[model samples]
Target: MLSFNSVSSRVLQTLNSTFNFTATRHACKITSIHAITSMKTQPNQVNHSVELGNRRKCLLDRPGLFGIKRGMITWFNDNGRQFPATVIEIDSVEVIKHKTEQEFGYTSVMVGAVDKLKNVNNLKLFEQAGVSPKHKLGEFRVRSETGLVPVGAELKADMFAVGQMVDIKGITKGKGFAGVMKRHGFKGLAATHGVSKAHRKQGATGGNQDPGRVLPGKKMAGRMGGRSSTEMNLEVLHADGDAGILVVKGCIPGPNKAYVKITDSVKLYGKSIESIERD
Candidate 1:
């Protein structure tokens, strides 16, 4: 006697054999086999439920190696919240030269300013890099040995899109010689204590004979800003190719008209709010 349980098991096994169930780390694909079946079963097909496997992140999901180009400072306002941002005119970042690991010890692309250089800080460096003279120059490494953009290819603001994060590198505005309070954000001396005109002076920066005189890097009055700085994970507010502008949210290093470099944020790229927790 064919019991109902046994009959059902046989039917399931037959159906399983008919349909090819291929499972992978990314997805489950079920390919149906062409087989004649009863009209009732055909119309009322039993749907097989699959608890999908975890999908692996693909190469496309990962942000690729990026390039650097000079940008200018601009302002962006969102809902009355005005923000000073650095806007790069990335309409065209001509690839001046390509360096190889075999010949140059490392792979990199030397890029020059958009137009003829009005002021060049390092003419010898540009000459060695085999690029035309420009106001400024930068190098970005390539991921693969053959990852090279054509020498004359023009890179636009489109390289970085709105909502994407980037690291803005530039020279911070020079404040000249400044007090410790302003330079290192040191709180001024006690308002009512024995402190006199030394209110803004960095307190007691001396060490014992073991360490010798005031520490080499004592936080005393010194030059502030005017140094290379990198603002990381700055979100892109907008990007315009025609205007050659890229608006980033929040402030970046450098004063108005100062040259800046924009590149993919190392820690923030290809990350979502839920996946990323950063201060």
Candidate 2:
């Protein structure tokens, strides 16, 4: 017969071995299950990332929309910093036609905004697109055929997200026949020493007689503004799809009710959504 102490010791050893074996088996099962689940999810995560990247690339490559200038307002960012923002109204923007690379040597889309009487030249195109006549017509070039928008698809201001950078092209306010001092920011001649009524005139355009007559591109008093201008890297502050309003940071070139073309920033083409979120 074994002593009580020895018998108890033997039983405890057996129980400990059994518990260890059970725990080890359960831990292994859990680890294997976790690994299998991770394996199943890994491909999905990769595909999701690829999809986001493609969408971002497509957004960058796609054509832009047309809008009307709606004046400016003060805006505050998340950091409580105030900025002057320009409001743009997008209405009745639709794809008018598509230019194919095979036929046009490059890919682009013709878009129009603001309904108007159908012009004879665009009657056929508008009828085919099933859209009303547009008053403001603009063409935007795309990187590839995939960026072409479907004809007659209406676009809204919501296409631009807050925090996205954009470039606005428009006709600036006209200042008819401005002097050099106002147009080109030229400093007038001294008002004290010996300056007379000619103080406001631009002093001596070209050299004495080297190249003779004023240079072809000489800067002098002339018409100011009213020309096509582009304001680059303007940040989108807000976008309302239903209302078709886009608020952008800083001033845009144009007067109220003037049509403007809004496009993604060419300078920030390399930036992606991830980088924007990081910033």
Predicted model with the maximum TM-score: 2
Error of 2 at 192 (Å): 1.6
Q: What does candidate 1's lDDT look like per residue over 58-146, in tens digits?
A: 11121222223345355646666665665555534556677766686555676766556466666676566456666555777644355
List RMSD in Å for every model shown: 18.1, 18.5
Clashing pairs in 2: none
TM-score of each: 0.62, 0.73
Query: In candidate 2, which residue ranges exceed 4 Å CA deviation?
Result: 1-60, 117-121, 270-279
lDDT by residue for model 2 (113-194), tens: 9998634465777899899988888788776677889998999999988899999999999989999999999998988887
